[model samples]
Target: MTRIVNCVKLGVATEGLDEPPFPGDKGMEIFENVSKQAWKDWLGKQTMLINEYKLASFDPKARSFLADERRKFLFEGNNEMPEGYVPPKD
Candidate 1:
């Protein structure tokens, strides 16, 4: 059976990740409180952040920036789009 968590991002009880998506304490926190769907959503946003800022994944500073942004997005509900980003029209 899938684990269910009272997702902090979705504000509902839903299917949780099998394991922490991240590492260490933050990952454990997410594994305990965030849903699978919310983590997937963050993955998309994280990609956009990486592309928009031209961030190097191997760089420590870039990794730190993404970690901070992830916490803010998941735990604090602060989903700031990249500057001057426009959504594609359907």
Candidate 2:
């Protein structure tokens, strides 16, 4: 049976990830409080953030920025889009 968590990001009880998404306390926190769907959504947003900001994943600063953004997006409900970003209408 899949694990269900009180997802902080989605504000609902939902299916949780099988394991922590990253290494360390933050990852464990996410594993405990965030849902699978919310993590997937963050992956997409992270990609957009990297592309929009021209961030290199190898750079420590970029990684730090993404980590901060991840926490804000997941725990704080701050989903601010990058400046000048226009969503494609389908």
Candidate 3:
């Protein structure tokens, strides 16, 4: 049976992640409160941030920036896009 969480991001009870996405309190918090769909949405936005900013994943500053963005996007609901960002036509 899939785990269900009262997703903080989507304001609905939905399927949860199988394991913590990180390895500490934040990860556990997400595991307990975020839905699979919300997490997937964050992933897509994360990819966009990485690509648009030309962020190097191995860089500590980039990791920190992404962490801040992740919290804002998932919990705070106020993530910002890169300046002048344009979404690709689907």
lDDT for each of the candidates? 0.94, 0.96, 0.93
- Which wins on TM-score, candidate 1 or candidate 3? 3
- The stretch of ten residues in a row with the least summed lDDT in candidate 1 is 80-89
Clashes of each: 0, 0, 0
Clashing pairs in 1: none
TM-score, candidate 1, is: 0.94
Q: Please give the RMSD to the true structure for each candidate, in Å.
A: 1.1, 0.9, 0.9
Best by TM-score: 2
lDDT string, candidate 1, 1-90, tens digits: 989999999999999999997689888999999999999999999999998899999999999999999999999999999889987689
Sort the predicted structures by TM-score, highest score first: 2, 3, 1
lDDT of 2 at 63: 98
Q: Mark the 10 consecutive residues where model 2 has the least summed lDDT.
A: 80-89
Regions of model 3 farther than 4 Å from truth: none
Q: Candidate 2: give the clashing pairs.
A: none
- TM per candidate: 0.94, 0.95, 0.94
Residue 68 lDDT in model 2?
Answer: 97
